[model samples]
Target: MIKNEKIKATEVQLTGLNGEDLGIMSTRDALALAKQHKVDLICMSLMTSPPPCKLMGAGAAKQEKQQEKKKAAKTPDKRKVKEIRLNLQMEDHDRETKQSQAERILTKGDSVKLVIQVHGAKEGTAGKEWAEQLCKSLAEYGSKTTGIQVSGKQVVVQLDPIE
Candidate 1:
């Protein structure tokens, strides 16, 4: 936006800092008025007849409008598969707490992958069983999104939030 001599329009529709109209006047006169108001004369829309202008300063409302525009452009996180690992030795309460955490993640429209990692000789079979049990318990919050799979000592189960 141009101020004073920089403005091409001979006359402009002036709006005060408080959003009050200051009537149509020459760009120079509008600039003088803005000077009196201790603000900058900014031409808002210049293509139309008698271009519209505003009195702006450090407290210009345009700043807030720009801030709001920036805020509106933000987007929510895109859906991604989240992982929640479990221990074969976890107590019942610990297992329930982890399942609750998975529920919270599912509620946000993200898939949850439950992994039971064990370090013992029976961990392969035992981990898969534990993973299956966790998926069954999570039925109220979500549905199994993927089949449980066992790889080495780890068993994985994925669940999606109910639509």
Candidate 2:
């Protein structure tokens, strides 16, 4: 914000200390008025034809900026959830690769949802066991947030990164 002696515009749209419009006036007169009130003549915006300037205390402006910074710092960023699907009859090598992928995701502070699906008539009984074992193997990287859920031919569980 351009202030006082630095304001190049001969005339400015001035706003008073109490937010009242003082109309378009010479910058010298506005500076004098600001001096009279022991405040600052800060250019609020430079985009207009006759830039709008306000009379504000320098300390007040700094305090407002600090308050905004504090508000921003208080808000937390949201984490993303990654989904990985597994087959009930996955081979040992493939299972190990999937486990490593899940660990990588968890290390990055993201949640992982594991979905295990079984096909055919006789594979339903072992799906839950397979899912539970996979979850247990990944326990070091993340903790289970949801219990194993069995619905039809699928078993699902969610793991959240360890803080």
Candidate 3:
């Protein structure tokens, strides 16, 4: 998390709230001065050789920071991944429907996971090829993050984030 408020220091060469130079003093003395004027002691810069700070409204400053965080979180970034499943013998119509759903999810800035199940005898002969074909078709909808992998009787592939 990042802080957005410019804090005021207690003492030192008091750069006024608006950046005016007010000379030096102790943190306690500066805080007292700000208190007399009804303000907060904000530490703006503490990394200098002697450390520098500022003064502001603690509550208002915190609220403004929270608002900025909320705004940033609301801005969509295309890095989240969503998952979908398919069976080895899934009908063409069903596969198409699932692909449509995947497209919707990807359009909203999400990656997709295509999971295929290979059951019993279906796991033999051309099961692996079938899985590969399913992965290929899905890749047409979105970039491939991970190629198909067979684990026991299931195949899994991850889709890259949609552009």
Candidate 4:
């Protein structure tokens, strides 16, 4: 439906083709006026005692309404999660690259998940320390906008949006 489709006032005020008021009249008179103008009698408001309506080209009005609906539907909501993965033993260059990727994702209005997976016997104290260092580096380089948490063998960091 058109935005604020309802018309206000009891005098059955009509609007011209350029949206100027065409004065008040009875329902029958308005219908006759619409017929004379070769347009449709559209009931815009039913709140008043006699209700208020409009006289306009039905096809053009419907097309405008559909266009507005499509415009509203195309707008994107901002609260969506986007995920990125990393390994516990990722090299300095690879970690930097992944961090850049996460930054890009956050810039696009998405939350990023930085996952670090640990494997085998190498998943010892050194591995944990390495994970912590990586997390710290990511936080420092990414301006600490990310939320970090540890879950067993995985170190997950959620990157916040830029401003």
Best by TM-score: 3
State which candidate has the highest lDDT.
2
- Candidate 2, residues 47-158: lDDT per residue as tens digits? 8968998899999867867998899999977778899999977898998999899999999999999888877446666877877887888888899999988888787889
**Residue 62's C-alpha lDDT in candidate 2?**
75
In candidate 3, what are the lDDT values of residues 1-163, reduced to their tens digit? Answer: 1122333333354555676766677766776777886766555456663345455567865885799889999997747777788886778899789878887776666788877778764473355676566556656567777766777777777776545
> Which residue ranges in model 2 land beyond 4 Å of their true spot?
1-76, 120-122
For residue 125, what is the lDDT in candidate 3? Answer: 33
Query: Tens digit of lDDT per residue, candidate 1, span 23-46?
Result: 898888888887897888887776
Provide TM-scores for the models.
Answer: 0.50, 0.55, 0.62, 0.49
In what order do the candidates fall by lDDT, top score first?
Answer: 2, 1, 3, 4
lDDT of 3 at 104: 77
Error of 1 at 81 (Å): 1.4
Instruction: Estimate candidate 3's RMSD in Å.
Output: 5.5
Candidate 4, residues 1-163, lDDT tens digits: the string is 3212233332475666667777677666776777788886666555665554567798877986799889999997765776777776678899789768876766666766667776654564444565456556555333334445555677665655555
lDDT of each: 0.83, 0.87, 0.66, 0.63
Better candidate by lDDT, 1 or 4: 1
* TM-score attained by model 1: 0.50
